[model samples]
Target: MLLVCVFGGLGTMVRYIFDVSIRRWWHHAFPLATLLVNVIASFCAGMAAAGYVYHTVDQATSLMFVAGFLGGMSTFSAAVSEMVSLARNRRWWLAFSYALMSMVVPLVCAAAGWGLVAVTR
Candidate 1:
């Protein structure tokens, strides 16, 4: 429990660091910071999953990566919040694209990750 909490806090801090850095760099024209953070987190999550399945890491380590780090890093609420903000601002197309991409791309990425692992293993 304590480990989870500590790792979770670390993950969130990493996320906030990226969020602030990207927002400063890009100035929030869209939710670029959020998207970039999520994507990088997802990729890291994929690598962690792959690492776990290949037995490069044990179950506990896997949980630390997936449940602790990725869980804290890749935020569903942030994506939803951005979408809601878009809708509330009446940017229908942008909102719809964001929503759709959010659903489609991550699934595709996960599948791709799993497939690559399967093929190699």
Candidate 2:
């Protein structure tokens, strides 16, 4: 539990840094930071899942990575918040597109990550 907390803190910090760094360059209205972070987290999650399946990672480690690190790193709520903001601002098309991409892109990224790991073995 303590380790998990520590990992979570670390993940949160990393997420913040990534968000700030990306926002520095991404001055657009879209929430690219959150999306990219979520995508990367999803990909890492897929890798961790595949690692567990291949016995390269144990159950506890998998839990730490998925539930602790990635859990902190991914910001689902922020994504939703951004979507809502977009809608409220009358960018319904962009909001809808963001919502759709937020779901679909991560799934595809996870699958790609999983496939990469599976093929390497």
Candidate 3:
């Protein structure tokens, strides 16, 4: 629990830094920050899941990485908020596109990450 909390805090900070930097450079209302965070976090989650399932990750490590870091790094709330903002602003196409990419890409990345564990192991 302590490990999870500590790592979660670290992960959240990383997410904030990463998202802020990207938002600064991109300067768009497309939710790129949330999208990137979700995708990367999903990959990490997948890998951590696989590691735990395969006994490569012990309980503390699993709690820290899976329950802590990835949980902090991913932002489902922010993603939905972005979608809502886009729709409210009448950017239907952009909203739809963001929504689609946000779903599809993360799934793909997660699968890839899980498959990566399978392959490497």
Top model number, lDDT:
2
The estimated TM-scores of all candidates read: 0.86, 0.97, 0.94
Candidate numbers, best lDDT first, in rank order: 2, 3, 1
Better candidate by lDDT, 1 or 3: 3
- Model 3 regions lying over 4 Å from their true place: none
- Two-way lDDT contest, 1 vs 2, winner: 2
After superposition, which runs of candidate 2 have C-alpha atoms over 4 Å from their true positions? Answer: none
Residue-wise C-alpha lDDT for candidate 2, range 1-121, written one tens digit per residue: 8878878888999999999999999999888999999999999999999999999999989888888999989999999999999999999888999999999999999998899999998
Model 1 clash tally, residue pairs = 0
Candidate 1, residues 1-121, lDDT tens digits: the string is 6676778888899999999888877864378777776777776677668878789778888787778877887888999999999999999988998888787777777667666776777
Error of 1 at 49 (Å): 1.9
Provide the lowest-lDDT 10-residue window in model 3: 23-32
